[model samples]
Target: MNTNRTPNPPRGDGHAHGFLGERAELVSALLALTVYLTGLILELTGNGGPATLPLFVAAYVFGGFFTLREALLTVRRGRFQVDFLMLIAAAGAAAIGKWEEGAVLLVLFSLGHALEGYAMGRARRSIEALGELAPRSALVLRAATPVEVPVEELVVGDTVLVRPHTRVPADGFVASGTGSLDQSAITGESIPVDKQPVADRAAALADPAAVDAGSRVFAGTVNGAGALDVVVTRLARDNTLARVVRMVQEAEERTSPTQRFTDRFQKVFVPGVLALVAVLLGIGALTGEPFADTFYRAMAVLVAASPCALAIATPAAVLSAVGRAARGGVLVKGGAPLEEFGRLRTIAFDKTGTLTEGRPRLTEAEAADGVGPQELLRTALAVQRLSDHPLAQAVVRDAPALLGAAPARSAEPAAVNLRAVIGRGVTAELDGEEVHIGSLAYADSLAGPPVPAALRERTRQLAESGRTTMLVRRGERYLGTLGLMDAPRPDAADTVAELRGLGVTRMVMLSGDDQRVADEVGRAVGMDEVRGGLMPQDKVTEVARLRAAERTAMIGDGVNDAPAMAGATVGVAMGAAGSAVALETADIALMSDDLRRLPFITGLSRRAGRIIRQNLWLSLGIVAVLVPATVMGMGIGPAVLVHEGSTLIVVANALRLLRYPDVREARARR
Candidate 1:
């Protein structure tokens, strides 16, 4: 929740100053307790009168200063904070010659505040831990010599020398190196990812723009066992780690619905409490009770009715959950999304990247009558070699393995006059003959014979099975057709099933791919519906439709899906570590590309929502029982004990979420 208190700046692992510091409040509480105990001991020894009174006075002042200051500040702002009620209760106890009880009240209240601060500090440690991962300085390579420099001084296009076991200095493409890197800080991945040099023309022919294993490294990932010469692609402050830290900090500042409700409740409830105390004092004076007794009873009413537990209920739980979720690689933008995620009834996912590997793989190839398989393979490779599309890469990758030999990379006459038929296919002259390689319609567009019934039937079979068909032709003869499939992720089916297990009643796949391809992928992943061939705006319309019916979340990681994701009840960006826009645009960003994080985050949100409710009810339940009991004459000491005890209970319950088990770990156990 947004508090009047400005958030402390991003801290390192070291302790902060002031009352929020872990050690400061704790030391204050201990000092006050020590003085309080000394006062009790003096009274028991029958040497109490002036000496014990001084000790109690010292105890109250030391233990209650921060709370008293907060109470006064809140009063100056014309509001009644929970501390205001505690301050009044303690003052009334002191006025009634109950210095021992008032001292105890201050000490316990300060101790609770100390413990709560420590707990919240622990929660904020996740973001603080991120700050510690980046090194203050890095080795920059200037003019073929390595010179150590502050990270902030390194600019884009500057080369950096990253040594073995050192953190990557910046986000960049490797100039020369091959090694594994521990990316847990950015992606929450447990295993080290092996990276290779950026693709030369040959490798690009096989897999274009590959992310991992393609020399692209991010800042804060530890380089392993090998050195790298990296060309800095981003400034230090604009690195992936910096953006993650910033997003997390911004997310925590937002207020949840429950927190707002409590804030509003306090605005009314605090003044209501003051009026109730006034009525109690009025009735007691009318009934002829002594002024001291009447004042003591009103103080009891203040302590019993104060909403300390309620005031803290939502923030504690949200901060705890958001922190732990960040550690688990799920970035919840705020308590609003955290609460909305818990209520998500339907989840719409993009087909590629979200459910599938997002790249095509060659699966089947057929040669025409009287055409040998090797000849057909070589011919297809010769035509596809001139293109850079995903299907072309799929063909290029499998050609060598399938043929047991590489295509002839001759100096001349193998293929020439290559041309691209944008989104349709590629054409080239092979061995002094015109050749066409692409979809059936593109082949028809060329100066070629019509496709035979047999070839047409084969294309239909591949399309029906959700595979893209690439037809190869030599002059007027149908050469062959290759089937390419963008395979579903290994975890896709399990993720879909688990999401349903977690009460996601409706799951759909929205894709810009062919209808058959989309439907086949949805069936494999166990989705209830599949909508394919959608333009970007179409996805937005579908998401809006779903949101109008029920709470919906759109999970995507592409430019096309951004609008739709923005239109949903919650936008979940998968593999956000690779995309800065995803991190910024999504309400919930999963650092890793893994689909399983979805169910995990949803489950965690559900647990957080339940905890918030439990805390609220528990807080109000204590008030409902204690307020009337205090009015009916329960002593202030016991009432204070119960009131402060309930506040601690609510905080402790929220802290339990910090230890909530990870979904991946649970799956690993199974």
Candidate 2:
């Protein structure tokens, strides 16, 4: 439901543009390699001299095209870069009459850049493919006749006809049909979900995207066997897929803390390597060693010390992990949260809708001694159905089927002259008798300061067990009591157990529900702490307190949870499919709404961290070994081999995350 308005990506041709740029770089690198090899063959076969020198020069020109371009631009900006250092080393090799070695260096460097670009393109393509999941054109209903139009032309209120086997064109509601949807692409749901028309006119009016989750459908899901008339609630650019793509793009642009540290390291590392190379040349001249051998050794040291592998290590791993998470329906906002997720040890949950199913169910219904149970139930339904309160919805759904229908002698019963008594209950007239349905206190405040001992006892028992009970009265006579409970989610306990397994031992539930009900749910979910009966501001205070003690994460899916989420180190939103507030506010959004994804994302973050540390050490370790060996006696050819070889090895290691398995599966393997 996130509707943050980023400019929509261009339709139809964006992926092609990205593909072509990578292909061009690769072709240039291959051409340089071919030239360098041909020059080598001529020299070894005794066809070498001044005449053949031009061939090696051409090889250097082709090989250094991208490196020289970037190096020149970086120099103009008064900045030092790895590319600039490589260009200087290659030119130094040529000045020392080692033209073949200079050509070899440029060819390998350009080819490494090309091969890495091709590897990184896989991550970029995964994001670009998301924009194309929904069809380009939608069969929009135009005055009862279906006409195909570009998806971008779709606006709110347009009725789109989704035919079987086609992708849904925009996020909308089922206005006139029922069917099943394959939402595996959007929600990672393994089974096709049964969908039907669900009407909530008021919710759709206030925020079309905030409608009930069961009733909503998103773009890019494959339709099942029935035709559906979907009323578009969001514009094309504000759909679920669009928001995900925008967030991923933003994530790649933002640097992580590790990337920032590496950047600072490189600023000093690049300049210092250049100064060391210069000092080596000056010493060789002072000692009167052979100029060619000393100069060649100094150039080799510069190539080895350039920090090429170090520069790409962290970013490569971060990008691969971000792309992998997006494919599994987890949207990480940026690299900062990706890193923070792995380090979180204290996670707080909001109860009402988060830990539980969010829907209240009727568990018990009873009547007084003189009251007919059917009569009591019918009368209660008439009064409760008209109530515009949040708690009344579930009872209204449960009551109609149990009572069947009104008698032939009377019209459909409805409460007239209705008035809500705010927090206490509701008051209205049913067939001219004053009827009320409210808490036990509200009933006691009326009907003689108390109902009956039996009714009070039942109410007390239900409340003690964490079930909410309401009393019904008809003027001066008491009717009956109704008990309801918001049960905990089936997977809540297992998810908490897995989180504990992942090293997050402190799991707390912060709820606005009654203390007793919250405690029951917290225990059911296997949480270590329970803080219930908290207001929105109180939840924020608790989150701030938790943050003071440890790195905290707050997870919820409502507008009220926003403040507490902002206070925590990381704010995670569950079921963010259609809520703009959830999407914009939470640092990470589980697009699928499955609690299992929580552990998956956390595991993925931890795995990415391990890979990043490995990369940094491997790259730094190579630079450590190569710089000293080249200074002592290593030749230019061997130095270039080991240095570029380490760069390739680091890139290959980071790409392993693109295939990281689910946490449960990984544990099974181990």
Task: Estimate, for each residue in 186-295, the C-alpha lDDT of model 2 and write its tens digit.
Answer: 77665677888767544664577556666689999999998888889888988988888788878876777888888889889888998898899899999999989888
Q: If scored against the real structure, what TM-score would every candidate get?
A: 0.92, 0.89
Using TM-score as the measure, the top candidate is 1
Model 1 regions lying over 4 Å from their true place: 1-20, 44-47, 200-213, 404-413, 422-424, 443-450, 665-670
Candidate 1 residue lDDT tens string, 145-262 = 8899999999977878889999997877777888899887777666788887765534532442244534678888999999888777778888878887777777767888888798
Global Cα lDDT for candidate 1: 0.82
Any idea what lDDT model 2 has? 0.81
